[model samples]
Target: MFKEQVLGLMDQAELQIEGKRKEIDRIVDRNQWKVIRAFQKHKVSDYHFAGSTGYGYNDRGREVLDLVYADIFGAETALVRPHFVSGTHTIGTALFGVLRPGDELLMITGRPYDTLHKVIGKPGDGLGSLQDFGIRYGEVALLDDGSPDYESIARCISSSTRVIGIQRSRGYSWRPSFTVAQIAEMVRFVKEIKPDVIVFVDNCYGEFTELTEPTEAGVDLMAGSLIKNPGGGLAATGGYIVGKAKYVELASYRLTAPGIGGEVGAMLGTTRSIYQGLFLAPHLVGQAVKGSVFAASVFERLGFVTHPRWDDPRTDLIQAIRFSGPEHLIAFVQGIQQAAAVDSHVVPEPWDMPGYEHPVIMAAGTFIQGGSLELSADAPIREPYIAYMQGGLTYSHCKMGVLTAIQNMIDRGLLHLEDN
Candidate 1:
């Protein structure tokens, strides 16, 4: 009975997503070519191998990896480090390293990833945060149509505004992720207002989903987590900041300290894995994107509201589905957990996860802890009760996960396949 029902749903999802297969293939091939070109251009040789403990500053493999990433992303310099921690941490470093006291930082996008909220800080709220450092902050909410409010941005920009921050991914928001082209337009607009204003993109789950990166589109600097799209489901831990030489240098200084910028951090025997992960990132991202499309189609067919509908142009790996209420939301998340390769027997529930405003449920059963490159799903406990699902190393695994989620919903009576 399980096989029959799940297979039937899978068949439906396949048909629904068939129209996007060609587009997905085109993107995959183009990105794969980019990766190959980067490797060839950098002359990735055997000498670029990692040593045990990896304590020296002369790791050719680490240098080559940085070079390859910079070349691939069209940045003047790049810093890939295991020491920087999460995406939020990397972004924090970039912000703090560049902006000084009395300088202003403008966030044109709506509220960024939940974790960044604490970093931005509230007036008289967070200690040692941007606000606490005397770095002023301002934000302009997206218009109802989900587009940037240019007028609001214009009104908000101050002479003290030294940086314009853009988040490429939607984060936990319901808005659509911005495409490379969209980011390019934003760069142009911001530059017109203040030519020297630094434009930085928080490129978390948005890497490699398109042919070009935000840096290529005139972004001054960008940061992302190794556990997310760029890691290719292989890197154990790390983060990357790639862009203009000066900005990257400053971030490196903040990551380590003044004068030690970008020179001393060791790869700690993970250079080979990081290199291998980048090599595989393009294809792995494509597979994850395919899974997102499949998820959108399957859920939309089941009468749930979906962001970036299956046929919509995908700019990132996330696929969001709105549930009827908390029950349906919890069930869906538990469903994803049940589908995981690791901890399939463990049940997830909402809890006060630090750095977030509300309780959150996460289904992250990855071999590498918190690796978004592997299959996972998570959602904050809140209104509209939407779950943000992303990642699957293989399309087949993603497909199975969708089926498992559907089966779970069916079992819980939140969904009735027969009724559908």
Candidate 2:
């Protein structure tokens, strides 16, 4: 019955979507080869499969993982650690490690993710925030058309600018995330303006979603959480920072201490999972991307506005759907939560979640606890009622989740398929 309903909803557009799926399959094949080549080049061996216990110095597994990440990202070094709490933590470490008192951190890509606001704090406020330590923050808003204002960026650059930040994913934002080619252009423009300034990218949900990465585009430093795209739904917890040798070293020092720096952190039996996750990441990311495409096509046909449409080039896994009202948004999230493999019984509601500017409703019924790599849906209680849905370990699971969301909305009278 559900399949019939889904088919009826598709209404003869199956062939077109299938063509797009074929293109996604080709992208997956190409990305899989890239991951394989990086693994082969690093000479991954059985010795690298072992995990480290205490004070994980000179651990072969850890060393090889770092090398694999660096090679994949075209970076001089990489620090992949399960110790880092979240993407926000990893990003904060990188910023604090590189910038100094009285230095400036300019975000060229407009406002950052809500979580980063605390890290960049109000001046003279939080003791641990960059602003408290005398670091200044500024952002050049994207133009009305969602394109970066290059003129504003050029004007913002100054002698005190230490790092030019870019968020590769559109975190909790309505705009489309920047593609790797676009990020590369930003890198070139920023470096041309201030050759010494570090170019840092918050590569959260953007990893392995495309043929290239921000690091490959000449970014000086980049960070991502293991619970996002790179984890492949396997890693329980972790984050990574990869970049120029000097900057990575500095970030590692910030992760640990000045002298210790990426040497003493133990894997705690997570080495195998991290390695296996990276190995599986390309294929899993492809699955998630296919799911996003499917969701976009299906939702668009239902008369809802979708970002990047079905045939658009995808640089990230997120698929945003603008609902008619908050009722539709809440119902959609509730449907996704009901379809979850974990914590499905509990219903989510709008709450003042930490690090968010408004009440946020999140359907993160993931095994890893906030694992965006698993199927999830969330939205802030704000305008346009757009819900950000991302991740699916398998394409079938994502399809089911999307269908369930539509069905739930229909049942609640928030959406009417027949009317559309």
RMSD of 1: 1.3
- Candidate 2 off by > 4 Å: 1-3, 10-13
Candidate 2 lDDT over 277-337, as tens digits, reads 9888888888888889888888888888998788888889899999878999999999999
* lDDT (tens digit, per residue) of candidate 1 on 252-357: 9999889988777677778778888888999999999999999998888888899989999999999999988998888888888888888899999999998999
Task: Judge candidate 2 at residue 363 and give its lDDT.
Answer: 94
- TM-score of each prediction: 0.97, 0.97
What's the lDDT for all of these models?
Answer: 0.88, 0.89
Clash counts for the predictions, in order: 0, 0
Predicted structure 2, TM vs. truth: 0.97
Candidate 1, residue 169: CA error in Å? Answer: 1.0
